[model samples]
Target: MSTFQYLLGICVAVVTFVIVIEMLRRRRLRERHAAWWLVAGALAIVVSVFPQLLDTAAGALGFDVPINLVFFVSLFVLFLVALQHSSELTELEAHNRAIVERLMVLELKLEHQLNEESQ
Candidate 1:
């Protein structure tokens, strides 16, 4: 990469890292969710600082182009994040269902008691 490209990469990576930290400090992002972002930012910084590392990795992984490897990894990370969200959503739905069922039961008992009291 040219000098300009290197500087741009480093700047972008640093900005991304800083943004993630700022979000964390402001409580906009939870620690658990930020884990992947932090890792990604760190990796980006490392790769930006040492572009050769990405080339070596791409070569080892049989990728003809280093950028292609970056794209693949990014997609993989996104897929994992989506899968994690789906799992959490399923668990939350289960909990919500249980709470709703308990609420209905409680309402029925209260209504029965009110009817008996009136009679």
Candidate 2:
């Protein structure tokens, strides 16, 4: 890689890492959500610092092009993050439904008591 390319990669990776940390500090991103990003950022930094590692990994993994390997890893990480969020959304929906049902039952009982008292 050219010196400019190497420096650019390092800068970008460092920026990503710093952004994740800033988000966490601001409470905009929960630690659970940030975990994957942090991992990705760290990996990016490592790869940026040692570009040869990418070539070696790609060769070992049977990828003809190192860039393709980077693309694949990025997609896989995104897929995992999406799957995790989907799972959490399903759980939250279940909890929300239960809470709504409980609230409805409580409201019914309260209404019944009020009717009896009035009568």
Candidate 3:
């Protein structure tokens, strides 16, 4: 890889790592969710610093181009992130539904008690 490309990748990776840590520190991002980003940033830094490693792996994997391999790995990482977020959203929806149901039941009970007392 070119020096410029390596430097740029490293810079981005470092920046991302720092931002994720800052967000975690600020309580803006949950630790569980930020784990994936930290891993991605570390991988980016590793891949950027070791171009030869990627080259060898690409050759072994029959990827004709290293950039293509990089793209494939990046896409897979993004897919994992998306999948994780989807799962979290699904869980949140389920929790929300349960809470709403409980609230409605509580409201109905309170209304019934009030009517009985009034009668």
* Highest TM-score against the true fold, candidate: 2
| Residue 111 in model 3: lDDT | 100
Indicate whether candidate 2 or candidate 3 has the larger TM-score. 2
* Cα lDDT of model 3 by residue, 43-88, tens digit: 8788878878888999999999988998998898889989999999
lDDT score at residue 28, model 1, on the 0-100 scale:
100
How high is each candidate's TM-score? Answer: 0.96, 0.98, 0.90
State how far residue 94 of model 3 sits from its true place (Å): 1.1
What lDDT is reached at residue 74 by model 1?
A: 91
Q: Give the per-residue lDDT of model 1 (tens digit) for 1-119.
A: 79999999999999999999999999999888888888889999999999999999999999999999999989988888888889989999999999999999999999999999999
Q: Candidate 2 on 1-90: residue-level lDDT in tens?
A: 799999999999999999999999999999999999999999999999999999999999999999999999999999999999999999
Ranking by lDDT: 2, 1, 3
After superposition, candidate 1 runs with Cα above 4 Å error: none
Stretches of candidate 2 exceeding 4 Å from the true structure: none
Native-referenced Cα lDDT, model 3: 0.91
Report, for every candidate in turn, its global Cα lDDT versus the true structure: 0.95, 0.99, 0.91
Candidate 3: residue 16 Cα off by (Å): 1.5
- Cα RMSD of all models vs. native, in order, equals 0.9, 0.6, 1.4
